[model samples]
Target: MTNSIIKSLSLPAPEEIEVAIRGQRALATYLSTRLETQKIAIQDADNNTHQIELPTSALTLLMTILGELAAGNAVQIVPVHAELTTQEAANILNVSRPHLVKLLEDGALPFHKTGRHRRVLFADLMKFKDQRDTNSQKAMQELSDLSQEIGLY
Candidate 1:
């Protein structure tokens, strides 16, 4: 995806948050069943009703997007196979571009050079992020345990 599209994912407005709350509730009602596909009827602004079949996976994704919007969070949907610039990857990781470059140089993250610029696979970036988060959580838990053992808590 283009940087413009990524940058455009701002927090939903108050009106949109209300709409997302309602929409998420409505959509979540259909997920109670273990069906492979869901048939949903939606009314348009003109009051015309149309039925559409949505895969369960797509329905779940929509629910997640709506949930984030309802909570006033910005969401960006990136394809797994997409190649992102270093800056874009840094933005996603909430880290500085220089830090990300250092990680790449240290072989902590996998990246490939496209022409003179470095490109990171979205999937690879996610994997690295997940690992980093897991490590952070583990360290936090260890610290908490140590504090408790030392009567610091």
Candidate 2:
């Protein structure tokens, strides 16, 4: 099944950033141990309290989100197994949609056809991106070494 569409999130306000900073600090304190699960007590605006057990992994993810919010960044979570549209994949790579399509046609990236639409697995796309980034870094390093050898760097 197709995953839900990605939604744009607005930047956090000053007050929200402050709250996120506090929340991230509070959450970080609980992550010092190697516990599989943690029991947390939460209070609502109406003064109602609830206790819930959450996986440590989930808590760490929450802490990361809070840290991003504290830094005034907007964040979105995508499942690794989700299928992404060409446009969405392009957005993630900061590339144009036509370039993404060309890459797909050239076999630089893997995709499957759903009827007539092409869908890229998020995991495959990420793997391709990581490789591309590594290649770029290697090329830059080579260029820098060449420049240094020529006494121009």
Candidate 3:
């Protein structure tokens, strides 16, 4: 039998969160509290920047999530399409864009160009990422064995 979801744990509207935190704009205060309790990080462009020391956009996004939480709705969000440029895909893969372009050119991942713009599918990104993760695990095991044989720190 499927477990029934509790109403107390749900996400709400981003816009509503924005309105709720409008006046003081204490994004860090609000987010730190939520993040400390929840093992979730806000994937936001604004949160990546700190010169201003405030994540207005992230705040808005979180507000919506908090509102949903208050409303007792459970949801998990993911991208429908990768819709990323070569540079963006490289960033997602933590690799150089030139390398990603070469992979695309070599047919490693399915991608298409619209005029001059190239876009990669999210599914392809996920597949490549899984492969990379698996390879990393294999390499780590090999290195650990080598380290033990050599008695290297």
Clashes of each: 0, 0, 11
Model 2 worst lDDT run, 10 consecutive residues = 1-10
Question: Candidate 3 on 35-130: residue-level lDDT in tens?
Answer: 323333344566663233444555556666555544555544336463667776787688999999999999889888878878876677888889
lDDT measured at residue 72 in model 1 versus the true structure, 0 to 100: 95
What is the C-alpha local distance difference test score of candidate 2? 0.91
Against the true structure, candidate 3 reaches a TM-score of 0.47
Stretches > 4 Å off in candidate 1: 1-5
- Candidate 2, residue 5: Cα displacement in angstroms equals 4.0
Ranking by TM-score: 2, 1, 3
Please, what are the lDDT tens digits per residue for candidate 2 over residues 1-153?
275446667899999999999999988877745888989999999989999999999999999899999999998888888999988899889999999999999999999999998899999999999999999999999999999999996
Best candidate (score: lDDT): 2
**Candidate 1 clashing pairs, residues 3+ apart or interchain:** none
Candidate 2: which pairs clash?
A: none
* Model 1 lDDT tens row, 1-153: 335325666778999999999999988876845888988898999999999998888889999999999999988888898888898989889999999999999999999997898989999999999999999999999999999999999
Q: Is candidate 1 or candidate 3 better by TM-score?
A: 1
